[model samples]
Target: MKEPRPDEWRAAFAREFQEQSAARFEKIGKQLQFKLARITAEPLPAELHELFKKKEKALD
Candidate 1:
């Protein structure tokens, strides 16, 4: 069989990279959701609450 052309190789690499990035983001999203659930189950520390308020003010 003939070897793949440069463009074909680039396309294949791009597709693989996209798939890997999507999968990684999906995993990170799930992990964040799990952590959020756990955090919500307990009382947040005062420092974190203050930090969140500061961030909110910064956003506004």
Candidate 2:
């Protein structure tokens, strides 16, 4: 069996690293979206709700 050249090995390593990083980022993004959806779907505490409303008004 022939060993891979150094450049070939480096390219393969880089491709694998990018794939793993993208997968990790996607997993984190999904978790954040789920958490945000849960928080927004439920009733908020009065103070927090009021604070968000004020922030929203400021943005408008």
User: 1-60 in candidate 1: lDDT tens per residue?
Assistant: 999999999999999999999999999999999999998899889999999999999999
Q: Can you give the lDDT of residue 51 in candidate 1?
A: 100
| Per-prediction TM-score | 0.70, 0.70
Worst 10 residues of 2 by lDDT: 40-49
The residue pairs in collision within model 1 are: none
Prediction-by-prediction clash tally:
0, 0
28, model 1: CA deviation in Å?
0.2
Top candidate when judged by lDDT against the true structure: 1
